[model samples]
Target: MKDIVLYDRNCHFCKASKRLFEKLDWMNVVDWQALQSVNRPDFSQEELMEEIHLITPKGEVKKGFFAIRRMLLRFPLTGLIGLILHLPFLKPAGRFGYKVVADNRTCTFRKK
Candidate 1:
């Protein structure tokens, strides 16, 4: 089973995130899906657009920073960072940071 990630296709930040993570998926274990195209009964479209989502091979769902951490764990080079994010004290902070960034993703890019 593959680890599937759901993201908004229209969001530049989301698209960039997908590209970055896909590059780290050297073993080809991940499958990325655009939120507008996939029929995800488990989550509403609005909910997905609010943050990134990852469906684990075991059918567990992870969102935002948790999803990102999971993706990081899949790569050898980034696994250490992933483990750091899982530390109990850092989890909440990580989630908050992810929300702040995700909520204002448009700010990350602008017309030049």
Candidate 2:
């Protein structure tokens, strides 16, 4: 089973982010889905809207920054970045940074 990343298709930032992943996913280990278009029984609509989600092959779900880290680990080019993010001292900071970006994504894109 492949890992799936659910994102908001309607958001400009989300679409751009997906394009970046498409370019980086040379191994083709990850799949993409539009959150608004998919019905996920395991996750509520509200939960899906709050942040990005990565559904692992083992059925585990990683959300927000952790989701991005998990997806990054599968890409050889980005694996080092993921490893750095997972470092003991940086994990919290990574999560915080991701939240700040996630929270501001709409505004950032809207200004474009």
Candidate 3:
């Protein structure tokens, strides 16, 4: 079973992140889903929109930087980087960086 990543489809930044992840997913260990397609009762629309969410095969749910961290560890290509991101000194920065991107959904880049 593949791990699932839930993202906001309407946000171009979110879409870009999804595309970037797709490129890094050499093993195809993860599956991407739009929040609109998800029907879980525990996940509120408002909450899901706050950041990208990852649901593990074992039913563990992680959001924001933690979600990205968990997903990265699944692929051999990014496993080392994922481990590095988990360092205590980097966790705060990781979360902050993800939050900055997530908070600003207005996409500056246009499809050419």
Candidate 4:
């Protein structure tokens, strides 16, 4: 039971992101589960695909930029990025940025 959990598999970008976090703090504030690794009644594949997924030990679920922001808070560098997104006016911009990234992620990882 990790304190923070992110839903991701071997996605190239996701793996890259995870590697960066791993390099920063071996303390391991986060855990990851491939979509296939768990049966989550609360979220369907369709829903998960539409947003980033994060679950806290408190059983709170957060999605989109909020999820990314949550993960960023664990590390100093990323915490800065997260703080930027936390700005009220920047929230919508952060969401737009996430959608753009999410929409383009398939270019890097194609399904067989």
lDDT, candidate 4, at 99? 87
lDDT of each: 0.87, 0.89, 0.88, 0.73
The whole-model C-alpha lDDT of candidate 2 against the native structure comes to: 0.89
| Every model's TM-score | 0.93, 0.93, 0.90, 0.82
Candidate 1 residues 30-109, lDDT tens each? Answer: 89998899987878878988988999988899989999998898777798999888899998899899989998999996
In the range 1-112, model 3's lDDT, one tens digit per residue, is 8889998888777788789989998888899999998998989999998988899899999999999998788778899989999899999999999888777767554556
Report lDDT (Cα) of residue 105, candidate 4.
Answer: 78
- lDDT per residue as tens, model 4, 35-85: 667788988878876766888888999887888887787666677877777
The CA lDDT at 11 in model 4 is: 65
- Summarize candidate 2's per-residue lDDT along 15-80 as a digit string, tens digits: 989999889899999899999999889899998988999989998999999999987888889999
- Candidate scoring better on lDDT of 3 and 4: 3
Which pairs clash (backbone N, Cα, C closer than 3 Å) in model 1?
none
Error of 1 at 106 (Å): 1.2
* Candidate that beats the other on lDDT, 2 or 3, i.e. the better one: 2
Over 4 Å off in model 3, which ranges?
A: 107-112
Steric clash pairs (candidate 3): none
